[model samples]
Target: MSKSKKSEFRPNDYVVYPAHGVGQIVSIEKQEVVGIELELFVISFEKDKMTLRVPTNKATEIGMRGLSSPDVISKAMTTLKGKAKVKRAMWSRRAQEYEQKINSGDLIAIAEVVRDLHRTDDQREQSYSERQLYEAALERLTREVAAVNGADEVAAAKQVGDVLISRAAAA
Candidate 1:
């Protein structure tokens, strides 16, 4: 690995994997793969009950990153309070966009997805796919919020929901 590519992650550190939301580095171990010794970060996603091994050298390249800072979290909260932007494009195309945003591991982009897809009780109901995408985006956002705030997922989710509700009332 290049000097700049040195591993910045350590065991027990919480990190965000682009496609997997938040996970902890449970350990760093070495294994022989194809006769080459590779160092891996063993990440455990408690919510999903899954374990992932990512090579240390490739962590940054794969978009695995440390948790978002407090400032970023605040920005995401502000984003949630903004108006929702629903495009007139077809649902399938929009859904693909939302999915990409959620998986991009960009907190602000995920917030945009949440804002765009949020529904108030009085608004027209969401279809099954819409509901699924909304929940996924919401979950991804809440997980990072929870990790950054050192709070439980439920509390983080409530905080996000409150922001959305306030936005709805203001609109």
Candidate 2:
């Protein structure tokens, strides 16, 4: 890769690479792959006990991005505490749209889904499909928050729940 196009990855950076979810940059190294010299972002995830070495130049190309800013994450938290926006549209249609957003690897979109699907106090039971989407969105959002906040997944999830629950009560 040309120096002009060199990777923006930095050591200790928290990045999300779509398919892999949350991963910590364990190291950056120069290695010869085949006949070319390449820089790699060494990322590790404990849940899968997997280590992925993504070529620096290919980071963005592979949907890798830095963690959201604290302010952005904070906004997402506030959104979670707000009322859900249930579209009266067909469930299958909404599900497809939500799935696309979730797979798009965007934190804000995932947060929107979490906020919109969240069931408040004494609400009717969620449909099976609704529960599935909520879980996926919540998982994705929490993983990114965990990476950005330097907290474990469970802790991050709890943090999200607390924020939303508090806001729900205040409403």
Candidate 3:
């Protein structure tokens, strides 16, 4: 009761899907969903479960985007290790802005979150919410890095984490 479309994805392509960070074009396939045509791309991650997707053109503008360039990813990774302003403003206010940056899917905006929320090793563990938000930002950032670098998601995440951890210790 459904039709499948030929996939237009190739290996090592970089893509960003707002909340999910960046993922490579792992594979594409067609499946039936409610008696309608559905295409999907299979994406892998080191930190999270693998994900599936359809064509970008057919998607409601989500899923399966090429990863960012190495230079761009580098900037984000480096930026995260830099000093940033931690607004003394109430968290509710800052959180709103953080949410905005994560959703923007712009590497720099996401980087800001990573930089601001980053906790040093000497610092006490982050609050539950802070850790949650940091993971979210890291995942998003790592996804892009993994996709672009052709590295596993977990490795990419560790790379970013190591940098942040070291930066915090030094500060």
Candidate 4:
């Protein structure tokens, strides 16, 4: 058996794994592979119903991180209140950029995606791709907010939605 390494994360701690969103660290395990010992963090994504194991040492390099601070969340909400910066670029190019922002695991960037894609009165309806990107960013954002605020996804989503809606109404 491999030896366990002390980690900042503990069981029941919520963390973000870039490719995945919010997950709870269920446990730490040590395993031997080909006679090499590795310490891992076992995380569970309840919404995705998936479990992921990340090497303890590689967590930071791989963008695995703890919940966003209140200040970070505040900044993201401020970003949502800003006017949308829609580019004149093609949809394909914009979609690619949006996907990158969502996967960046940066709260502010994800909020930008949500702010830009959100539709308000007198605005045209979103295309299918736009909707998809918006929902993806929104989901990632809400999960992080939920983890930080100790709220469920729905409540977090509503909070984010309210910010967007009020901004839209003002615009």
lDDT of 2 by residue, 5-76 (tens): 454768787788787677789999999989999988899876679999999888887788888899989888
lDDT for each residue of candidate 1 in 37-146, tens digit (9 for 90 to 100): 99999999999999999999889999999999999999999999988889999999999999999999999999999999899999999999999989989999999999
| After superposition, candidate 3 runs with Cα above 4 Å error | 1-14, 24-55, 58-64
Model 3: per-residue Cα lDDT over 63-97, one tens digit each: 33455678888888789888977899998898888
Residue pairs with backbone overlap in model 4: none
Candidate 2 structure lDDT: 0.83
Residue 45: error of model 1 in Å? 0.2
Look at candidate 1 and tell me the lDDT of residue 150: 97
Model 2 RMSD in Å is: 3.0
Q: Which has the greatest lDDT? A: 1
In model 1, pairs of residues that clash are none
Candidate 2 vs candidate 4: the lDDT winner is: 4
Alpha-carbon lDDT, every model:
0.94, 0.83, 0.72, 0.90
TM-score of 2: 0.79
Per-model TM-score versus the true fold: 0.96, 0.79, 0.70, 0.93
TM-score of 3: 0.70
Q: Give the Å shift of residue 42 in candidate 3.
A: 6.7
